[model samples]
Target: MILTVHHVTTYEYDAPMRGAVQSLRLFPSRFDGQRTIRWDVAVEGGLRGGNFRDGAGDKVEGWSLRGPVSEVTISAIGQVETTDTAGVLRGHREIVSPFAYLRETSATWIDHALRDLAETAVTGVKEPLDRAHRLSRAVSDAIAYRPGTTHAHTTAAEALAQGEGVCQDHAQALIACARAVGMPARYVSGYLFAREDGAPHEAAHAWAEIWVENIGWIGFDPANECCPDARYIRIGSGLDAHEAAPIKGIAQGDGSERLDVTVALEAVQQ
Candidate 1:
């Protein structure tokens, strides 16, 4: 299957920003089940400073605002060819180390709640792959998918207690849980091909990947209750959302600023 994606983000400041620097992780990843055929990122009211790969192996571009700009626009367009591996990304070259994934981050703390959740999710389950699937399903059943209730900073425990959250929360919760169980888990940010629609959506999707002894790293999307298929496009991988965030930056002068983001996709079947 082939998937095309278009993602646009705009930042409007209440007051003009001077000497602003921004980092972007909007580029799709090239991996075993996924191939980036063509892709380009464009910026308006901003100039590209440099491009580099981040710790998470995400292709990132650094940009500087042009002339104390009041607004900045970033757009990315791309096409990728993907194959279904039944959640098994076999024979793929490993870009990340499993041991490295165990390191804790601020957002993915292994707290009591996480430990308890992990115990419940994996209990009475045998087989590493099957345990992962069961945990994913348990998360889906435990948390209701709802919007406008949680933010990017919401913690795994908070979302679990609330009983509802978006994909980010789901992924984070799963990560926390998996980590608590001594599984090397990391956060994944990417595009999920919507069944009713297609690639791009209101926002990029989030998923969790756990490392198994033989299989290495395998993706599990608790929100979707399945492993990633051809419809899933890999982007970045990190300890948590903060590290894998699509856009993050700081301005020299900061009073208050408003951010507006829009992401859309048009599917081109092949």
Candidate 2:
């Protein structure tokens, strides 16, 4: 399947700022499951800076804008060809050890409830792959998908206790549960094509990936209750949502900032 994406993010400050700096992980990943066709990223009135692939194999680019400017916009447009690998991340190159993901982040911190859930889900399940699938299923069963029920800063424990959240919370909760079972897991940010069932879903999405002993990293979308397939376009990953965010930046000024984002994904005609 071929997917085309258009994503735009805008920042508006009440007062003109002196400058702004941004780090972007907006490019698609390189792997057997997905190949980049054509991609471009641009920032209006911004200067592009150092760009490189991080240890985790995601492309990172820097940008800066000098101002007195009150508004800035970043846009990314791309096409990618993807194949279903049953959520297995094959042929992606990265030097970071999977164990590095075992380190907990504030967003994915495990509590007694998470530990118990992990243990109960994996109990009597021996195969690492099976354990991972069980964990994903457990999280899916635990959290009801509901938008606006939680905030960006909500932690895994809080989400689990609340029993309702969006994709980000589901991904983080799954990450915390996976780590509780001694598995290395990380959060993934990307785009998901509209479901065949026509269910409502955000074009921009988040998921979790767990390291199976022999399987490397495999993606699991508890929000969708399935493994990633051709409909999924890989972008970037990190220990939590903040790290995996496609855009991270700081604007110079005391002026308050308002952000608006829009993303659209569609299947390309063959």
Candidate 3:
């Protein structure tokens, strides 16, 4: 399938601030499943700086805005052809060892409750792939997809306890659960074309990736209860959502900041 994407993010501040700098990880991942046809990024009134592919094989770019600015906009326009890899990340060039993801972040810390949940989810599962599927299903059943119930700082344990969260929470919970079962897992950020109700879900999306001994890394969306296929576009990953954030920045001055994001994605029949 060929997919076209247009995304824009705008930051508005109540009080005019000084300088600002941002690290953007908005580029799509290079893998056997996907190929970028055309991609462009623009920063309003900002200077572009050095950019390079990180060890994880995701392109990271830097941008800076000068003083006395109240708003900054970042936009991306691109098209990509994707194949269904059944969630298996194949032929992706990355030097980072998968074992490194074993370590848990604060957002995905596996506490006693999480450990029990993970253990119970795969009670009879013995194989790695089957275990992963069971864990994903268990998490999906455990949490209700309810936005605004959890914030950016909400942890996996917190989300599980509340039994309500968004995609980020589900991803973090899956990571925590997978790690609890002695599997290596990390957070994935990208785009999903459809929601459970078949609505447009293609925007800033998050999921989990688990590393199997012989199968490599596989993407799983516990929130959506499915594996990534042709409809998914992976961008980058991290130990958790905070690390894999699409945009990370430091503003020189700020009283309060509000952000708005818009995305457009559609299929191009080929």
Structural similarity to truth (TM-score) of each candidate: 0.91, 0.98, 0.97
Candidate number with greatest lDDT: 2
lDDT per model vs. reference:
0.79, 0.95, 0.91
Question: How do the residues 5-122 of candidate 1 rate in per-residue lDDT, one tens digit apiece?
Answer: 8888777787777767888888877567888889988778678888987655678899887557677778888888888877665654445668888888777777786778789888
Q: What lDDT is obtained when candidate 3 is compared to the true structure?
A: 0.91
lDDT score of residue 29 within candidate 2 = 97
For candidate 1, the lDDT comes to: 0.79
lDDT of 3 at 70: 93
Residue by residue across 43-135, what tens digits does model 2's lDDT show?
999999999999999999999999888999999998999999999999999999999999999889899999999999999999999999999
In terms of TM-score, the best-performing candidate is: 2
- Residues 70-111 of candidate 3: C-alpha lDDT, one tens digit per residue: 999999889999999999999999999998999988899988
Clashing pairs in 1: none
Work out how many backbone clashes candidate 2 has: 0
